[model samples]
Target: MTNYRNETDWERADRNIGELLQELRIAIPGVQVLFAFLLAVPFQQRFAQVTDFQQSVYFATLLLAAASTMLLILPTAFHRLTFRKQQKERMLKLSNRSTIAGLLCLSLALIGATVLVTDFLYGSEATAVVGGASAMAFMVLWLVIPLRARRLG
Candidate 1:
């Protein structure tokens, strides 16, 4: 039993950070691709023909993807800045906070993408329907399910 637990707070913190980094690795690539797509949209020929609402959605999606990219990359910066220090516990705590923030940004990015895609295809009503559904699904999977599992398990 004693062997199953961390010997020190630092070890526990390191383990926590390791778990967070693994999760972020999974999230970062998708956001990076989304951000890249958003970055390229303005240069497309059809961009100028989009409606005002769609243009707004495009800008918002770009910003959300940018924010998510930053959030997802925060752990690496945090670790680099704190290298050779004895602050693993603090770093891990900060990284955990950053991960939560990143996930929120990711959720927003997904919602924005859904809005942009649906708007491009079927207009505002379709945008609302798809975006709302995607956001709800994200909330349930990223938040509710995790909380329930943590509490029950």
Candidate 2:
């Protein structure tokens, strides 16, 4: 097993930052697709016919998707802006924080996608059940699994 305590702080921070970037790579595509779909909804013929509550839900979902996408992408932009500044340690810490923000955004985006799909397919009742389940799963994957892995591994 690797001796984490023996590693320099910068080494540990670099590893953490790398892991975060990998996670964002997985998350970004999904969020982009969702955001694209949300953007197109307003252009659809049936968009105006959607109920007010559904419209509100759709708007909220779109916003969350947008925010998530931004959060996930911010670290890359930040790194580029700070490149050659000898700030790897600071960059790593900021990247990790951005990653946490991105995860929260991702959870919200997933819930929003679930809600948008379910509401379109059935109604609020079914949407609640489906979206709630998806939210729970996101929580487990984003929060529980990582915590457990870090603890056990």
Candidate 3:
């Protein structure tokens, strides 16, 4: 509804895809590193010393990272499948949704990782503070700010 450029729908879709892919390029590396770290965690000797709660958090965080990775990569796969099929608009819609969901998952994974580390290094008290702060920061920075800006614009 908000036209930033005087371009046709197809042109807009193409540009949106380009911008989305660029954003994904920025996000994918962090997700990969987090996922890799999660994957290698259980193999570490100290992993055996983790509390059951930590283990549960680790599993959830790993799954979140994996889901983020898949959702982030899905746009490219969708693009490939729809390539030259005159479905740019549809692709753009799916890509936009997938990217948003991917970012949400990534934020939750990062928060979980923070909580796990804080709990492991300190205790439940410190973990509670850090985890709450981390979640609030992500929510404000990633979700609230963007939505507020969008509404204002």
Cα-based RMSD of the predictions, in order? 1.9, 2.8, 1.7
lDDT of 3 by residue, 51-95 (tens): 999999999999999999999999989989878999888888888
TM-scores of the candidates are 0.92, 0.85, 0.96
Task: Give the alpha carbon lDDT tens digit for every residue of 1-153 in model 2.
Answer: 246477776677677778877888888898888889889989999887788877888888888888888888888998899878878877777777777887798788778777877888799899989988998998898799999999998
Checking candidate 1 for backbone clashes, the offending pairs are none
Looking at candidate 3, the ten consecutive residues that score lowest on lDDT are 1-10
Q: What are the runs in model 3 whose C-alpha is more than 4 Å off?
A: 1-4
lDDT of each: 0.84, 0.82, 0.95
RMSD of candidate 3 to the true fold? Answer: 1.7
Q: Which candidate leads in lDDT?
A: 3
Q: How high a TM-score does candidate 1 get?
A: 0.92
Q: Using TM-score, rank the candidates from best to worst.
A: 3, 1, 2
1-153: candidate 1 lDDT, tens digit per residue: 123684566666667777887888799999988888889989999888899888888888788888888877887998899898877777777877877888798788879878887888898888888988998999899999999999998
lDDT score at residue 101, model 2, on the 0-100 scale: 86
